[model samples]
Target: MNSGLNFLQTNVNKDFTTLKKNLKKDFTGLKKIKVALLGDSATQFLNQALRACAYEQGFEFEIYEADYNQVSRQLLDLSSDLYQFAPEFVIVFESTQKLQHKFNSLQKSERLQLSELKTEEVKNYYHTLNRQLKAKLIYFNFSEPMDGQFGNYSNKTSFSFLYQVRKLNLELMNLSQECKNLFILDYQALSAHLGRQMAFDAKMFYGASMNLSIDGLPLVAKNCCDIISAINGKFKKCLILDLDNTMWGGIIGDDGIENIEVGDLGNGKAFSDLQQWARQLKQRGIILAVCSKNDEQTAKEPFLKHPEMVLRLDDIAVFVANWNNKADNIRYIQSILNIGFDAMVFLDDNPFERNLVRTNLPEVEVPELPEDPSMYLEYLSALNLFETASYSEEDELRNKHYQQEAGRVIAQKNFTNEDDFLKSLGMTSKVEPVNKFNLPRVAQLSQRSNQFNLRTVRYTEEDVLQISQSENYFTLTFDLKDKFGDNGLICVVVLKKEVSALFIETWLMSCRVLKRGMENFTLNTIVEVAKKNNFKKIQGEYLATSKNGMVKEHYARLGFSEAGQLWELNIENYQTKKSFIQLN
Candidate 1:
């Protein structure tokens, strides 16, 4: 660790000092990415590293620093120099304490106003301090020392401190909805990757040795590299944790489910600790699955019977606990989940098992866990590797949902008619023009949707808002409710007026809501919008893609005439056809 630190400090000084020495003298014409760094000493290092990175990338980075613990200073610093910098990206560090510092200052003001702040407006408030957001991408870094330097203090990574950090997570999640490219880069997530391999003790550096010792500092250069990499490539989707001593201490296959330690006492406590932490990950909506070689029934017994099993079997989306190779199991889980190799994080105590998955599923991320059992908590806690800037409570039940949907598919064989099966779902669809609230989900669906999408026109939250506020265009989303559950915002539609015709700009639905006549109802709504807009005709296109063959003839199904190469639905011709879904 000491050697690693010495090597790291030397690397940082070399990287940063070299960048500063080669600083571009001309700041005028080159595309300037104005960046503001907020917080204390640790944050300064982050800016320096980022500036050097920017320099190496051959870009001019104009940087502004705000006083530590000075929320007023944050406000003041932005108002004066933000516009001057004209930052293409705003990287806010020491941000975990933003709300706390604001509250403390409000206590000082005595008349601090909370109502005056709007979730979206609070972001623009920064613009009032600096310049308008030229580059709308905002990356937030929430990292503090385990020694209780920045965030709340605790001896054993206390619940209170983790709770505050979680709060910061939620705030950024909500905040991200208000802006395009709002990213929360978990500093702790990136640092934990280095573990004991690096050092973060405040006093870890000294002189040329210090120059070589930057890795000892928390949030080292490698940590920066990982975060940038994660942001460049989106976070993984599934966390495939190994059972045996990994999920809980001791192997259930060897020790029997009842005897396997995982409760409030002895080795049980360690398993319980891991189970408890895993539940939080589920809550954030990241899919949790099991990939271990064990007797399937015996392994499941503990989760079902153990009162201390915080990770109930239902909480897990999939389990491939068999005698088969772990890599094969991961492939099986990924098949049903329909996610990318880059989206899965494999957690296993055995280096052999971890390495097997790495070699076979090279895209699957396998983060290192320290060898010592006592190091489990910090090793896992420090490696905050997953990122979900967009999350919801519904994410918690995602696994159970896949199971229920599977059951529904099995039950579908019982129905003689398709409408009977669809009606049995008790499906209800509520469609309205996209407003500020639905803009987030609508934009998210557009960004992620592929298969069921008629036209994959992705838009930002701001872009969605702009379309809605336009007189010539309209955008809207649908809320789907069924006997199973509320599907949340599951569909989107965008329409615009071009020439004297109604043009369907984009139409997409969550694949989860597909087989139900939601498509027909959605098209009916489009025609009504066209009728209301007094268009002579309506037009739409089918951008041929490998996956969208399911809806290739969608315009023809709506009784549109195949005119030339384009699909056209003149209002008079549309009225002649009786293509409409009977909304029950």
Candidate 2:
């Protein structure tokens, strides 16, 4: 292990203590979100850590915590307080000790039956909650026991108590595929990362029935915050890497491309692994950019000529290699990408450079890099910085698609007239209702799109599926293609039909398709849907958010008259809007 990460994981106990002391009031400008925590063991410390973590990430949390050992009662009863709380999120963290106690008390012949019954009860509870409330569920899996009586044979024995716990965890994972709103919190993974000895304190477990040690609370809380942030569309989308000693073993400017240590030998393997990891992220829609303190030509040599380089020029969306300050360079990269500073992660080997960027751009995440190159991959994997809430097929080709977008920008300079430029691109759109094939992408747009999202409401895949299947609701998904490339599944709009009006429930689009008349095309489609359904009025709304200020005047720009907080256009009086996009 590197000294830097070792120091960080070991010395953060004091910081967490200070954090718990200062968790009295919520921060300003954060959205108020309600949550309920139901667990089998004492969970006051976990709740405290959750609040502190949530507040740090700009969330004003109103938590409803049920008493210990109330999981079964709160879940089974329809009129329970858990349902009455009407939480937006429900977190369940049942203790492994309780599961083991039940298994140990059962006779040998009844062990397998007990596991089956417990799994069925859990599934029923989830189904009941899904039917009764709109809240998203976060259920934790069981942790392994410290010691099993059968020792090495415990996993091999099918009817053993330890074996049943493993079976239950696997069953939960498989069940999540069927339950769209159910997300499994991998507590066992966290326990393994921190080591079982450090995660479980026997004295605390015996005295107070605490599942995790006091020092382990902060890490667990951090993982919980990562999940919450990703669900709310606040996770990082870009990674800015520094070359030379950072991506390799030596300074590229001094050692030249041939001498830089990045191959399959010795310390080189670490940098090679790091590059492979970055390449995988690129394939999954995370933008990669290079910001190094070397000449542009010099930095290009390694990616161009190195035999073992996993990342090439085509993989990088933006490359800014100059002697200028890194903070300034990162701002330039953000401009080209059109993303917020909070969505970028800066990785540099120099402590001074990392501190410089952190001071200048406080929103950017600057992780403390380990001094030893060999520890880079392991340390980063433990952090889980790129956790995602959803995925789609389009994500795999995101890097190539963005490269084509850059080409379009250059092509635009060749034409003086804006309309001629747009026409030259041969832009076409396919407007269709959301179906089983496009359900995942539609839900992802709702979860990850913030700046282009009006009203900023989030929905799970299950919620979107229900909306699509409803008779009175209309779900629209837009796909865009131009001369440059295909931008797949770029926009999503949900409309709910009332007695005489069709109300817009969601209006979100990808930033990449902005200023291309997609919004105008979408409005025309909305009116068409309303006319076909025999609705009298088409109603919309624009909720102002710090990130969505660009769209505050969206309805007004589309000629909809404002009626207090709502915008409305009478279907008979509405005029069709013209657009260059050919709709299918």
User: Which candidate leads the pack in TM-score?
Assistant: 2
- Per-residue accuracy of model 1 over 342-425 as CA lDDT, tens digit each: 778888889999888889988898876666555576556654466443443455666666556656666789999988888787
The count of residue-pair clashes in candidate 1 stands at 26
Where model 1 places Cα greater than 4 Å from the true spot, the runs are 1-88, 92-125, 128-134, 137-233, 413-424, 436-439, 446-466, 503-506, 514-517, 536-572, 575-584
After TM-score superposition, the amount by which residue 118's alpha carbon in candidate 1 deviates from its true location, in angstroms, is 18
User: If scored against the real structure, what TM-score would every candidate get?
Assistant: 0.65, 0.96
Top candidate (lDDT): 2
Predicted candidate 2 versus true structure: per-residue lDDT over 106-139, tens digit per residue: 8888888765767787788799889999887888
- lDDT agreement with native, every candidate: 0.62, 0.85
The CA lDDT at 301 in model 2 is 91
* lDDT comparing candidate 1 with the true structure: 0.62
Stretches > 4 Å off in candidate 2: 1-15, 113-115
**Ten residues in sequence with the least summed lDDT for candidate 1:** 204-213
